[model samples]
Target chain A: MDKWYVGVDIGGTTIKLGFVTEAGEIVTKWEIPTDTNNGGRNITIHIGQAIKSKCSELNESYDRLQAIGVGAPGFIEMKTGFIYQAVNIGWKDFALKDELEKETGLQVTVDNDANIAALGEMWKGAGDGAADLLCVTLGTGVGGGLVTNGQILHGVNGMAGEIGHLTSIPEGGAPCNCGKTGCLETIASATGIARLAKEAIDKNPQTTLANKAEVTSKEVFEAAAEGDEVALEVVDEVCFHLGLALANIANTVNPAKIVIGGGVSKAGDHLLNPLAREFNRFALGRVASGAEFKIASLGNDAGIIGGAWLAKQG
Target chain B: MDKWYVGVDIGGTTIKLGFVTEAGEIVTKWEIPTDTNNGGRNITIHIGQAIKSKCSELNESYDRLQAIGVGAPGFIEMKTGFIYQAVNIGWKDFALKDELEKETGLQVTVDNDANIAALGEMWKGAGDGAADLLCVTLGTGVGGGLVTNGQILHGVNGMAGEIGHLTSIPEGGAPCNCGKTGCLETIASATGIARLAKEAIDKNPQTTLANKAEVTSKEVFEAAAEGDEVALEVVDEVCFHLGLALANIANTVNPAKIVIGGGVSKAGDHLLNPLAREFNRFALGRVASGAEFKIASLGNDAGIIGGAWLAKQG
Candidate 1:
């Protein structure tokens, strides 16, 4: 009988789950809608039921499963797998690991979603097994995960690798959801790029961006690809700040690979070319020489894959 | 007979050596002039001879010395202990570890000076045994070292903790020795603080600073303590940039202890108070909450003590 591990990624809207082998291959993957009712108390029960039903449908006994690894957003006590608060899931001080283990009758490990994604990339994605890696996810909000000496840095309070919250604008910058003003998330994330485009259009409605009903970060990159001045200016501003922030991070930790992922990264060369130039300009001469940039190849599978990695480690 | 490890801190002007026990106590310490003549070729030979002579003077056999650890200022290949360059000592591509091992007939370990100082602080100084720490030395030039998971983070190319080279004033900032402009070294170092004061004094001849023939960083801090408006502004500027840079670093690594050291650290509360405020202002609320700042207590002994730690590890 072959052994299997369950990898779960819990998000606000959906929970992604996968059955993975010891060698990191996903046997099968699926998603279930997150149950936020009753303050998300039913989340673990649903996950447990889903896992059992999937195993039965595949004619596999529950004994074939070895352990479980889970990824969740927000402040986590990595050792205890306790959630101090996960605003998206309406969970506070939740014993996620204990509950999941009880429900599934298996051992479990838990980590931050961003961290697991970074681990996934390190194990099977753009990280290429580099011992030191910096993975930035340019989603609705900028998210980051850092691996130093081949291990995740959870910090003193599990708040390590909050790269998006780094202050890009020291004064009079836009407000961020994190209660800070002018954070990198306010300028470099997907929403930030769209916001920049909106602000530009508000000032001068003469550009090609004005033709769109609502400009997205994708449209901004598209316009820049065609040499639109306003779009180009916005891209330059975003890359300059992002580049400077990354350079500072590189100076601090000196990672060998910087992996860019998430929806905003879909712009591909249009983003990488400008961002790389800025990174080189601001990084120390030697730090720049040592780092290589790569687009994340794992895509949406990163979270589940990363969750699988945690299980594999266990 | 008791065993001992030799710790060496090599500088351009002098080399500090210590005979340390396994328990991290320095039995005796001394200094010898660094032989920078002949392109620093004789440095290792001098250090080896000094260790042997010191043992003879103390009526101890050289056999009692277990191993040696050396700290040098430069870009080092941490694994092989090879020096890429140390401009102050005129050493380039020097095999520091192999040469020292051959000269002394003992195993040897070598690390960057800044890194050793950080490790020393962690072992016996202000770090208070914290596993994750950030130590910044604000001397003639700023230097930094990072300890993660109770080990020094040498990074991919041994350039991990280059905090001083982080770009603070990303645009039109003063040139740094590293060939970058607007580095944190240009605003927060002792030399940088003095430079800021000189520029301010040159622009306004009627200030209290004009009364002094020379305005060093010390004088600037003293004047600020006395509430001189010009000096106050300079102190504020330095702390703001320093605090911001530190906050960014904290955001990345989330250190539990941030140890500030070096000549400029002598300003004490005059520097710590304002710098702490800026650090809190710029750092994420949680990262700020988790960190405590302390002045480095080891002073000049940190380098040799840290070097001893390297030998102890060996």
Candidate 2:
């Protein structure tokens, strides 16, 4: 009899589910549209029903599911598995673990979504089983997950890997959404990259980017790849801060791997090459020798896979 | 019938020893001059003979000794207990653990001096037994040790807590001994404070600090306490860099406590008050709320006490 685990990744738009085997195999995976009406009350019920349907389709008994692990985007109480706040999902002070457990009659575990993504990479993706790794996601806002000794460092308040908020310029830089000025997120996120391109184009009327009404992160990378001076400068500034931030973390944690993910990372070697060069310039020589950089491989499936890792750990 | 652990803190000029009971009691302690002649070959023998003599003085046989733990100021190989380098002691690639074990006929463990100091503080000093803490030593240079889940974070290559090497200014900052420029140590260390004071006084000849023959970190703090303009500016600058460095680390690790140690910490509230203010200003509000700042209480005994902790763990 093969035991199974249900890994769920709850997002604002949709919920991803995975029926994972003990050996880290995903026998089946699917998604359901998130029902956020009425404070997300129907979210857990939808997930429960989806899990049952998946088990039936696979011709496996639901009893084969030993546990359910969930990855939710918010501050989570480690002991109670409560979602302190998930602004995207309209959840606050919700006992998500208890709700899912009651609805499905199964034990449940929950953790922050970013942390689970890092664990997913470590378990079956780019980390390649490295126990110490740092996973950085560069989307609308930068997010980070630090794994030490094969476990997530949740810190005292689940704010351990808030690398996005690190003060890069330290003086008179851009303002941040967190009510702080000169935060790394102000310059290195996807939104930050587009903002930088727009600012540069606005200052100089000759830039090719000026022809477009609005610039996106993808357009910025593309313009840089095509040797647009404005876009190149933006990429350089972004990589400079990203490198400094990564070096700071490397000096602190000496992680074996630094994995970059999310939309900005789609720039690929254009982002990684300069970032690695900058990282080498800032990182202590010994720490640099032990660490290597890689692009994240698990894309959207990272959350569910990381949830599986949590289930296995629980 | 009581068993005891022998803790040794090896320094360039002297060695500190402690005979500790299993219950974390230091029954007796002593110091011995270190003989670095002949490549420091006789230092371990002296430690072994001293431990034996101490046991005889207390009317107890060496058979009562459970294990020996050593705190050496160098990069140590955790598994083999090798001292990769101790420039002060002229030791390189030395099998310190094997030598001590062979000489004393007991199991032995070795760790970095700063790490042992942090362990000492956590076990019996200001950490108050908190499992997650970051201890920073501000001396000739800055040294840091991070304890998480009640154990040291050794990282992949034993360089996890190299916080001093983090690029603080990230641009044109002071040069460090590690062949890097603008590191946190170049601005936040005791030496850095003295240097900053000298530079500031040189630039403004009318300041009170300009009259001093030599500006030390202590003099700068004293002048700041008395409201000296140049000294106050220097203090602010040092605290600014120190606070930013700490906040960056706090954002990364979110340790429950940040413990300051070493000589510069003697300035007390003069350094801490400003540092706490800057740290809170930069730290994520949630992390700042959960983390507290404290001065290390163990002083010089921290090394030997931490060594005893390692012995107990072993």
lDDT of candidate 1 over A20-124, digit per residue (tens):
887777899999999998878899999999999999999999999999989998889988999989999999999999999899998889999999999889888
Give each model's whole-structure lDDT.
0.93, 0.90
Error of 1 at B100 (Å): 2.6
For model 2, how does the per-residue alpha-carbon lDDT over B1-314 read when each residue is reduced to its tens digit? 98898889999999999988887678899999988887888988998899999988999988999998899987889879998888899888889999999889999999988899999999888887888899999998999999987888888899999999999887788889988899999888899999898899879888878778888898899989999988899989988989998999999999999999988999999999999999998999998998889999989888888898899999
Candidate 2 has a DockQ of: 0.83
* Model 1's DockQ score: 0.80
What TM-score does candidate 1 reach? 0.95
Worst 10 residues of 1 chain B by lDDT: B201-210
> Clash pairs of candidate 1?
none
Candidate 1: residue A223 lDDT (0-100): 98
Q: What is the lDDT of residue B125 in candidate 2?
A: 87
lDDT score, candidate 2, position B242:
92
